[model samples]
Target: MSALAYSQLPNHLQPLLAKFYRAHNSRNRIRSEAICWVARRGDIVGGLCLTPVAQGHFLTGLLVTPPERNRGIGAQLVRNAVASSAGPVWLFCKPELVEFYSRLGFSVANCLPATLADRLTRYRSSKTLIALQNDQRMMPMPNATLNIAIACLLDDCGRILVVRKRGTRFFMLPGGKAELGETPLQTLRRELREELDLQLEDDDLDPLGHFQAQAANEPDHQVEADVFIARLPRAVTVQAELEEMAWLEAAPCERDDIAPLLRGHVMPALLARMAQAERVACCAATSDQGEIGSLAGKVSSIASSS
Candidate 1:
């Protein structure tokens, strides 16, 4: 990725980038004052721009050309831009993209400068946006550490479905360790069917990346889990080794019954995603609107659930 002030960018490249931003209906949000970080891989792949904010810098104009997505171009651009800053870097993106940004070590913004928070409030009305700040923690764990596959099922009401095995004390995500010759995804599919009585196809799940934490049930060992996200389509009944199943609140809570991986990494990430949604919903709740009231109610119901 090449980082240069918009003014210092070569003359010919200026129009090209302007064309790019305009294509996304966001023009000179890359003005001469902003620093544009462009990345090319055998072709002009994509670019992201950063500008100064009082607390730190805010990232904007992250445009990855349509044809080049899933190739990690946008991720690379984001990584480079974030590393360039010595202070907190913030950005707002659609809710669906939370996992992608979370893998890059960004969680929801805990606090924000008045200007960006107001901008986000305005953006939240028309677009379901979530504000995130770089936590800068995207280091990969060894895959050989533990061959485990896990699934996170988030319901429409925004709660995560968790299960407690027949003899287990902790409530954890529904999944299990991999068997020999099975890939993590395959392990996940089989485990889900066995424990939750829920059968899912490969397309039903989206990879959230891998995580490592001390095993909750297995002592003296750690688990390297390949985490995936899926929508909870229907009600699940406990089966096979599962003794009970329940919905876990997405909001942060001080519960001691959570498994290690769920407590350490996954919960924190989910909480970050919830942070923006809470503000969006609660902001509307404090005012008076039924639509927003529904969301606020959901949040309230979740926090109060047994």
Candidate 2:
């Protein structure tokens, strides 16, 4: 399967998309002005439409064919939209779906456009729905905002690999500033090879998101980072501009040497992800236990009857 984004609604895909939504029993339709992100496997299997608005971008129609559900097509569409969009992306969904979208980094919106706020109030009065927003933190750029791509290389024990550049006091994630004509993945790959003697393909990385935090080495500066997670194939040595390398605990206790970006923003996000994982695991275990008990009871009943 492949995905694509179209700035304008294509003339040929109009009817097909309309039919796609109808098959899913949705009445919402896409407008020509909205940006289109589509997932295709021989045909369109999933799609999400982004409509420009004063606040940011309002998502209009989102659908995935029944046969294509649980294949991560919807996630790809939403991730592409948020990463490529200039600002936040907003949507309304039923309460049951809140958990699904929340796993993709969406949260209940604290604020919204006056018109949308009003619309949500009226809609919620009649249905069980809530508003969500995915903020890219691009509304206003900070002073000396450096855009960098960084890696979150975790070890078998769940420790993160950190590096200190030559003559720098701060220890940061393994990455550097984006050079001319380079994407985030390109920057991460180049930086890792140069700094840590590590090699990786784009598919090896799981993009966390673009994040903003205080700059590590510079005073009164900020950094916008494209963060990713991947495994370390083997132990690494300091190389290139790196002077030292270290491993930080999943929740690091020492922060005097850690970079502000890692200590402040990245750590919190990581911890949140870990906590969510625990909750999911616990739920799955309980479900499995219940199923096991049911099977045992059935077996005992059959033995007694026989």
**Native-vs-model 2 lDDT?**
0.80
CA lDDT, every model vs. true structure: 0.76, 0.80
- Residue-level lDDT of model 1, residues 1-306, one tens digit each, is 232111223545666777767776765466665667786654455777778887578888877777555445576678788877777889998889898788676888889889998999998888789999874443344123455888889989878988898887988889998999787778999999888778899899976655667777766666767778889899888889889888887766568888888877777766765686689899877776777879998999999994
User: Each model's TM-score?
Assistant: 0.45, 0.56
Give candidate 1 misplaced runs (Cα > 4 Å): 1-145, 274-306
Q: After superposition, how far is residue 160 of candidate 1 from its true place, in Å?
A: 0.9
- Candidate 2 lDDT by residue in tens digits, 154-190: 9999898988999999888999899998888899999
lDDT of 2 at 25: 89
- Report the number of backbone clashes for model 1: 0
Error of 2 at 69 (Å): 22
